[model samples]
Every structure is written in C-alpha cells, then in structure tokens.
Target: MPQMAPLYWLYLFIFFLLTLLLFFMVNYFIKPFDNISSVSHDTKIIYKSWKL
Candidate 1:
C-alpha cells in the first residue's frame, strides 16, 4: 500500500469512532418494547403528580 497522508489517518480514525457509537445506539434501540414500558411509566408518574 502507498504511504497514507495525515488527512487519510484522520478520516480513518473518525470513521472507526462513528461505527462504535452507531453500535451502541443500535443496541439501545434494538429493544423498543422495553423502552416503551419505561417511557410509559415515567409519563404516568408525571400525570399522577400533576393531579395533586
């Protein structure tokens, strides 16, 4: 392979970091049902507090 310049190294590093972040984000959203339950619970609590 030809020698890589400074810009190429920077681009490679950024691409790698973004892929890692994407993996974490996908893992979080992969289970939408769990998130829905937790979100609903928070909403219910807020609504109950408002009634007081």
Candidate 2:
C-alpha cells in the first residue's frame, strides 16, 4: 500500500478542525433563532386562545 505524506496529514487535520468549528458555530447561531421562533409560535397560540 502507498503511504501518505506528513504534510497531507496536517492538511487533513486542519480541514477536519475547520469543519468541526463550522458545525459548532452553525449550531450556536441557530439555537437562538429556534428559541425566538418557538416563543413567537407560543405567543401566537396564546393570542388565538384569547380570541376564542
């Protein structure tokens, strides 16, 4: 089997780290929006109930 170079390993490691960082960043940013949307939905439901 052919062996990979050390530089290639380093590049792979950097790429993996970048992807992991992006994943966490997306999750972190998205959570607040999700909470906001859910809160708004709940308020809408409450408002609808009040109308009845």
Q: lDDT per model, in order? A: 0.82, 0.80
Most accurate candidate by TM-score = 2
Model 2 has an lDDT value of 0.80
Error of 2 at 28 (Å): 0.1
List TM-score per model, in order: 0.48, 0.55
Clashes of each: 0, 0
Across 1-52, the per-residue lDDT of candidate 1 in tens digits comes to 4576777999999999999999999988788677668977776644465675
Per lDDT, the best of the predicted structures is: 1
Candidate 1, residue 23: CA error in Å? Answer: 0.6
| Each model's Cα RMSD | 5.7, 5.4
- Show the colliding residue pairs in model 1: none
**lDDT digits (tens) for residues 1-52 of candidate 2:** 2366877889999999999999999988776666767867776644455665
* After superposition, candidate 2 runs with Cα above 4 Å error: 1-4, 32-52
Q: What is the lDDT of residue 45 in candidate 1?
A: 46
